[model samples]
Target chain A: MKKKILCVCLISVIYSLVFSACTKDVDFNQINDFEVSPVVESSLIFLNEPANKFYNNGVELTTFQDSVAIKIFKDKFIKDHLVKAELVFETSNSIDRGFNLRVDFLTDTNTLQHTFNFSVPASPTNSVLIYNYTEVFEGNELLSLLATEKLLFTLNLQPGEAINESTLGSIQLKSKGIFYLNIDNTL
Target chain B: MKKYLGFILYLACVIGFSQNKQILYGFSEIPQSLLQNPGGKVDNNWYFGIPLFSHIHANAGASGVSTYDLFADDGVDFNSKLESIVYDLKPNDFFTINQQHEIFSGGFAYGPSYNKNEYISFGLYQELDAIVYFPKDYAVLVYEGNQNNINRPFSLDHLNGVAELISVLHVGYNKKVNERFTFGVRGKIYSSIINLRSLNNNGTFITKPGDNNVYDHIFDLDLSLETSGLVNLTEKTDFEPNDLTKQILLGGNLGLGVDLGFTHQIDKQWYLDGSLLDIGFIRHSKNIESYELKGDYIFEGINPFFPEVGSGQTADEYWTEIEEEFEDLFTIDTVKTKYTTLRPIKLNASINYAFGEKLDKECDCTSEDSEYLNRVGLQLYAIKRPRLPQVALTAYYYRRLFNGLNIKATYTLDSYSFSNIGLGMSAQLGGLNFYIMADNFLEYNNIYDAQSVSLQLGFNYIFN
Candidate 1:
C-alpha cells in the first residue's frame, strides 16, 4: 500500500513538471517592437464652377482664393502618430485657360505655415481634359502641416486665356488626402 | 492593438475554464462528481473534504489561436505575424476561463433502512468565469483603416464579452427511487464580487464615394457596456483590502440558482445519466454602472463656400457648427440602473455499457448487480454562450483496478482540437480519498501549441 501511494505521488510530480513546460520558446518582449501603420484617406476639396462664376459683372477674375477650416492638427494624437500624408488633386479643365493653383496650410490665426503650388493646363478643346497632381508631405513639411488649422486654396488664371460672364463650360477640381500613421503603444 | 496582447495572454494562460468536465462527470469514486451530476453514484456512506484543498479546478481554452502562434521564436517577424493574425480574425473565435477554489465541503446519508436511504451534500466555493469573443471587424478597422475598405461596414456586433467573479453556496439532495432510477437536485446561492458585460451591441461605420466630395463617412451606432462591483473595488475606505475578501465570502450582490439531474439503469449492463447545471440568474443592484451610446450621422467634406447666399459668414463659423453637431450626435449616456444576468447554463449527458468481471461475484436476488469492473461510454457536454453554444463530445473507458483504485481515460472532439486526450485517477487508502484529472494530456509535451487545457484535483475523507 505504501509503495502504490508513493508511485502515484511520483507520477503526479512528473505530470506537474510536464505542465510547467506548456509553452515553447516565446519572446514576450517582442511586443515592445510592435507598431501599426494605418493609412487613412479623407476628402479635401471638390469644386465645380461654371465659367460665369469666374467673372464679376463681365470682368474676368484672375485670383480666385478660398479657405476651409481644418482642425485635425489640433489633436495631439493625430500630430504625434501621423508619419506622412499625400494630397491628390485631380482637375478637369474645359475653360480653355491654364491656371496656377497654390494650396497653403494656415494656423488658427491665419498665419501661413506651409505652401505647395502646381499648374493645371488648359483643355484646348470643347471636351474636358483631366490633369493629376500629387504632393507628398514628410520631415519638415510634415511637421509644418501638423502645425496648421486651415487650408487656403488660390487659383490664378494664366495669361494665355481669358473668360467673361458669357464664357461656356466650367473649371472643376476634386481632391483628397491619404494620411499615413505609425502608432506605437509605448509612446 | 499591442495592448490587447497582455489581456489575451492572461485569458489564454493564467485563467482556466472547465465546462467540459469529461473525466469528472461520471467518476463516482470522487465526491465532487456530484457537483457535475447530482445523481452520480456514491461509493461512501459519508464523506468530508479538507478545507481549501478539497477541490481546485481550472480550464482555459481559445477557439482560433494559441499563445505560441503569436509569441513563438520562429524566424517570422512579429509585426508581420500580428498583421496576419488580425487579417484572419473571425467573429466566432473566443477565449474563455473558469476557475474555482473550494472552501469546505461534506456529505452524509440518513434513513431508517439502508436500501431506502437518501444522501445530502453541501459546499461553498469561489469562482471566476470570463469569455471574450474576437471582434474581427473592429480590429480590422483599427489595423488596416477604412481606406481600402470602401462601402464595407465595420460591425459593432462582434464586440461581445463578459467576465464575472462570484461565490456559490449549495446543498444537494440525492435519492434512489426504487432500483431503476435515481434523481437529485442542488440549490445554489450566488454572491457576486465583480461583473462586466458587453453584449448585444449594434452599430456600423462605412465609407463610400460622396455625392459632392471624394468620400463620405457614415456612422450608425447603438451600443452599451455595463459593469458592476467595479466601483466598489476602486473606492478606498476604512474597509480597505478586506472588502474584496468580504465580497468573495457572500457579502455582495446576491442571487439564486438550482441544478437538476437524474440517472437511469436500463438493465444489468446499460445505464444512462444526465444533468442541467446553473439554471439561474443574478440581480446586480449595488455598485451598478453602465454606459450607452445611440446615434447616427453622415459626414461629407465641408461644403465649398459659395458667395450666392452668404451673410458674410466665414468658413470657420460653418466648420464650428458642424463640429458641434457631430459632438451632439455621438454623446455617450451613463446609466446607473440595476440589471440582471443569467448564469451560463451547462448540460451534461452520458450513456455507458458496463461489461467485465463483476466486483460482487455473488449477488442476492434483491440486490442490483451494478458492480462492473469495466465500462465504456460516450458523453456530450454543452454550455450557453453569447454568440453560439459551445459543445464538446468525448468517448471514455473506465476501469476499476481494485477495491481501492480506479482510473478513467478519454478522447474528446471540440471546437479547439480533435486530439484532446485526458486521464483521471482516484485512490482510496484507509478512508482517505484523493484524485487528479486533466484534459489535453496529448499536448503536454508541447503545451504552448495546444489551444485548450483543463485540470481538477481534490482530497477527501470518507466513512462507510
Candidate 2:
C-alpha cells in the first residue's frame, strides 16, 4: 500500500507540471482590440492693418513672415510611418477684390520643401465672407517630411487689385495633421 | 483624445473579473473548504496555513465582449472596431472584475475525544475583496459622440461596484445532534482597512437637433463616489508604506457578521448540505469622504455672436467664457459624511451521493461512522449584487486516487459562460498539505478568447 501511494503522488506532481507548462503565450495580436489616431491642429491669422497693408496693384503681402512649427510627429512610432497631413485655409475677407494665397513648407534654415497656392474670391458685401481651402499630403511625401523633428510653414497673400487703406481684409489659416499607426506583434 | 486613450488603457490593466470557484465547494477535506461551508466534514484536528502562501485567487471576465471581439486579426480599421463595441453591445451586457487574496489563514478544533458530537473551532484570516461592474452606457457616451444617436437617452444605471480590504476573526461551533443531523454557526468580527463604493446612480444624457443651433445637449446627473480610509491620501502628497500597513492591521472601520450552515444524512448513500456566508455590514466612519454631482443643464451651441471680433474681443476670450460657464453648470460637492456598506452575502447548497470503497479499507466501522472514498454531487451558488443576485449551478465528481490524494472535476453554468469546466486536486504527504484549482479549462490554450477565467492555489500543514 505504501508503494502504491508513493507512485500516485509522483504521477500527480508530474501531471500538474505538464499541464501548467502547456499554457499558450500572450501576444500583442491577442490584445489588439483598440487603436489610437493622434491629430494636431494649429491656426494662424493675418489682419490687414497699418503694420500689414493691402496694395492696390496686386502687391505681395509680407505680413505672414512668422513660421508655424509642427511638433506632434516627434514620437518614433508616429514618425516611422507617417501616413497623411492636411493643411486647411479659411479666409474671411472684407475687401471688395479677389486675392491669391500661397503657402510654403520650409526647413529650419528656410529652404522650401513644398508649396501650394489657391485663389479666394472677394466678399460680395464685406460681411466677413468665409472661404475654405484644404490640401492633403500622403505616402512618400508625408514620410519624408516626418523624418525631421521641426516643421516650418510660411504664408503670403497677394491682392488681385489695389485697395484703399480704410478697406480692411483678414485671412485665417488652419492646419490639421493626422497620424495613422500600426503596431506589429513581436511574438 | 490621447489622454482619453491613456485612461482606457489604465482601466484595462486595473480591472479584473470575478471567478466563481464552483469546483472548490466541498471538494475535499482541505481546511479552506470550511470557508465555503462551515459545517463541512474534516478528519484533521488542526491545520496551519503557510503564511502568505495560503489561498491566493485571481479572476477576470466580460459578459458582453471578449478580447477576441475587439482585438482579433481581422482586417478592420481600429475606428470601425470601436464603433462595433459601442453599437453592437447590448444595454444589459456588463463587465465584471473580482479578486480576493488571503494573507494568512488557519483553523483548529478542540473538544473531548470521547464525545464525537461536539467541537469548537477558531480561525483568523486577512482578505482583500474587490468587484467592479462596467458602465457600458458611460463608455458609449464617452467614445461615440451624441451626434449619431440623436434624441436617444443614455442612462447611468450601470455604474455600480464595491471594493474592500479587511481581516476577519471568527469562531465556530459544530455539533452532531444525532446520527442524521449536524449543524454549525460561525461568528465573525471584520476589521476593514479600506472601502470604496458607488451604487444607485441615476442620470441621463440626451442630444437633439436644435431650432437655433446645430445640436442641443441636455444632462441630468446624480452620482457620488464615496470612500473610507483614503481621505488622508488626498490631503498628503507623500506617505510611507509602513504607516499604511500599520493602519490596515487595526486602525480602520469595524463590523460584525455570522455564517450559518448544516449537513444532513438522508441514508447510507445520500447527504445534503447548505450554507449562508458573510451576512454582515461595515460602518465606514473613519476619514470618510463623498464627492457628489447633482444638477441639470442644457447647452445649445455657443452663441455665434459672443466675443465679437467686430467689438475688438478675441476668439480666445470667447472660448474662455464658454469654459467658465460650463464649469459653473456642473460643480462637484465634496463632503465628509459617514456611510454603511453591506457585504456581498453568498449562499451555497449541495446534495451528494457516496458509493465508492472507503479509503480506510481495514476499518470495521459502520456506514454511519466511516467516511466514503468517492462522491457525486450538484451544487448551487449565488451572490448578492447591486442590481440582482448573480447565480451559478454546478455538477461535480469526487474521487480518492490514493491514500492521501483526492481530485474533483466540475461543470458549471453561469452568466459568463454556459460551458465552464473546472479541476481541483488536494494532496497530503506526511504533515504537509497542498491544493490547486482552476476553472474554464477549455480556454487555457487561448485565454484571450475566454470571457471568464480563474485559478486558486494554497498550502497548509495538517495532522489527523
Candidate 3:
C-alpha cells in the first residue's frame, strides 16, 4: 500500500512539474515607443531646353512655367508623419544665358502656401556653368509644405546675351526631393 | 479591429501546434500510440477513446527567435532591440504552429478465434497547421531605407507562408504477418474549412543610379496569393454563425492521404519500427480566390524627353502619363483559380533495445514470452517544410513501473535547442486508461525563453 501511494504521488508530482509554465518579465507597452525612419529617394524632374525654345518667333522669351500635381504631400497619413523636407536643384548651362527658377507649393484652390527661388549663372566664355541649391523646410515651413496639393515651377531668363534659333547650346535642369521624414505610429 | 483580433485568436486555439508527437511514438502501452505506428503490437483486444476527452495536442515553435528576445522588460530601448533583431534573423528563420484533437476513436480485434491477428482502427480529428518564413531583406529595406544600400536588391521571394484548418477521418488496417513482422496502412479523407498560401513567390525591388535621373527604382514582381473559405472571416462580411460549420462539413474541397507503418522484431531483444504519414494532397476547387501580379517594370522618374526640345511632354503631362503606366503595370488580377497542395509529410524511425526482467503484459506468466520491463532507444524524426525539412534526433529511456503504469524520458536535439527534455506517462487503472506527455520540459520554468514547446493528453477505455 505504501509503494502504491508513493508511485501515485510521484506521478502527480511529475505531471505538475511538466505542465507548470512561467513567463518572464515582458512589457508589451513598449510598442508605444517603437518607431521607424525610412529615407525613400526618387527622381523628381528633368529638362533640357535648347536655346531656340527661348525664341518666340523673333523675340527672346523671358519666362516659362509649368505645374504638376503633388499627390503624396496632401495625404493624411503623410501629413501626420512628415516632420521635415528638403528639395535639391542641380542646373547646368552651356548656353550664354542664365536662368532664375521659382518653385511654388499651392493648395487645391490655387492658393500659394510656400515658395523658393534660385539663380543659375551663365557660361559667357563657354566654361562649365553649374548651380546647386538645397532648400530645407522645417517647423512652420514643413506645415506649409504638407498643406500643399500642387507645385508650380517658373523659369525666368537672367539678364544675359541671348540669340534666336541659330544658337547651338542647351540649358539643362535636374531636381529631386530629399524628404527627411520622422514617422510615429505608436499612438 | 477588436472583433477581428478575437476571431483570429479563437481560430488559433481551436486549430494550431507542432505535429511531431515524439514521446507518444512507439509507446505501445498507450492505445493512442497506434495512431503513430499503426503496425504496433496491440496489448488489448478492444478499446474506445473517451469522446471529446481523447487526444488533445498543441505546439508553437520558431527557428530563430523567442518571445523574451523582443518583449523582455530588461530596460532596453524597444527600437534598438527591434533593429538588432531585424538584422539578426535571416530569411531561413520561420515560425510554425500545429494543433490536433481527436473527436472520436476506437479499435477492435477481429477474426476467427483460431488466429486473431487482424485489427481495425478508425478516428476523426481536427488539425490546424501554419508556417511563415521571415523576409529579411524586406525588413531591412523598410527599417533602414534605400538611401545607404545602393546596390542591394530586396527580394520578395523571402515572403513564404501557409495556414490551413482541416478535419480528417481515417480508417486503418493492421495485420500480423507471421511472427517477425506486423504492418499497417491507414487511408484518410480530409475536408478543409480555411486555407491560405503565399509560397514559392519571387521578385525584387532595387534602387540604382540612372543616366536621366539621380536614382532609378525598378520593380520585378511575380507574386500570387491564394485563399479558400476565408471570405467570411472578416467583420466586413456578413455571415451566419452556422455557415462556418456547414463549410467544415460539406465544403467539397477534399483530399486523400495515407499513413504506412510497421514493426519488425529482430529476435525480441532488439526491435525496429518506423512510420510514414500524410502522403497526400488536397484539391482546392470551391470558393477559391487568388491574385497574381507578374510583370517587370522600371521607373526613371517620368523622363521629360527634352531631346525634342520644346516639342516634349510638360511636367503635368509626364506625371499623368507615369501614373497611367503604373496603373497598367501593377494591375493585380483576381481570378477564381483552383489549385492543389501537398500535405507536409513526416517520417519517424526508431531502433530500440530491451533488457531487464519481463513485465508479463498479457498476465499469462508464460515462460516462452519475452516482454522486457525496460527499454532504451534512439529515434529520428523529420517533417517537410516549404524552405527545408525540419529534423530532430532523440534518445530515450522507458520503464514499466508496475503492470499498469509506464514512464518514458527523452533528450532531443533539434534546431531549437540541444537541451530539450521530454517526459510521458501512461497509466491503466482497471479498464480506464489515461496518458499525458510534454516536450521541452526544461523550459517550463521560464517559457518566454523557449523557442519551441509541445503537450499532449488523452483518455480511453481498454478491454483485454
Which is the leading candidate under lDDT? 1
lDDT of 1 by residue, B44-140 (tens): 6899999998999998988778877888889788888898888776887888898999999999887766473589999999899999989999888
Highest-scoring model, DockQ:
3
The Cα error of candidate 2 at residue B356, in Å, is 2.3
Q: Against the true structure, what is each candidate's TM-score? A: 0.89, 0.69, 0.92
Q: Considering every candidate listed, which one attains the maximal TM-score?
A: 3
Tens-digit per-residue lDDT, B1-464, candidate 2: 99998954543333222546776788646777777777766567777778877777777777767776666556666467766776676544556655566666666666567655665566666666665666777766555435346788888776877777787777777777777887888888887877888886888888765543434567788888898877667675666777666665666688889998888989988999999999998888988888898878765533222223356444445445544666765788888889988888888999999886554445654454556777999988878766666677788988776667888888877666767888888889898988888887766666677888777888888877
TM-score of chain A of each: 0.84, 0.58, 0.88
On DockQ, who's better, 2 or 3? 3
DockQ, candidate 2, comes to: 0.09
Candidate 1, residues A1-187, lDDT tens digits: the string is: 7647865775576467435656568888788778888788887766778877778876787886777777778898998899999999888888878888898889878899999899888777747988889999999999899998888877788876668766777777777889998887656
Candidate 2 residues A1-187, lDDT tens each? 8757765675565466427534333334534445433332222233333312544455544333333444445567666544566655555566666666565566566676666778767764766667778777787667556644333333344444555555555543333233333333321
Judged by whole-model lDDT over C-alpha atoms, candidate 2 comes out at 0.67
Position A150, candidate 2: lDDT: 32
Off by over 4 Å in 2: A1-14, A21-26, A29-33, A36-187, B1-19, B68-83, B86-88, B232-234, B302-325, B359-370
Rank all candidate structures by their TM-score, best first, as comma-separated numbers.
3, 1, 2
**Candidate 1 clashes between residue pairs 3 or more apart in a chain or in different chains:** A22-B448, B16-B59, B16-B98, B17-B59, B17-B60, B17-B98
- How would you class the docking of model 2? incorrect
Quantify all predictions' global Cα lDDT against the true fold.
0.83, 0.67, 0.82
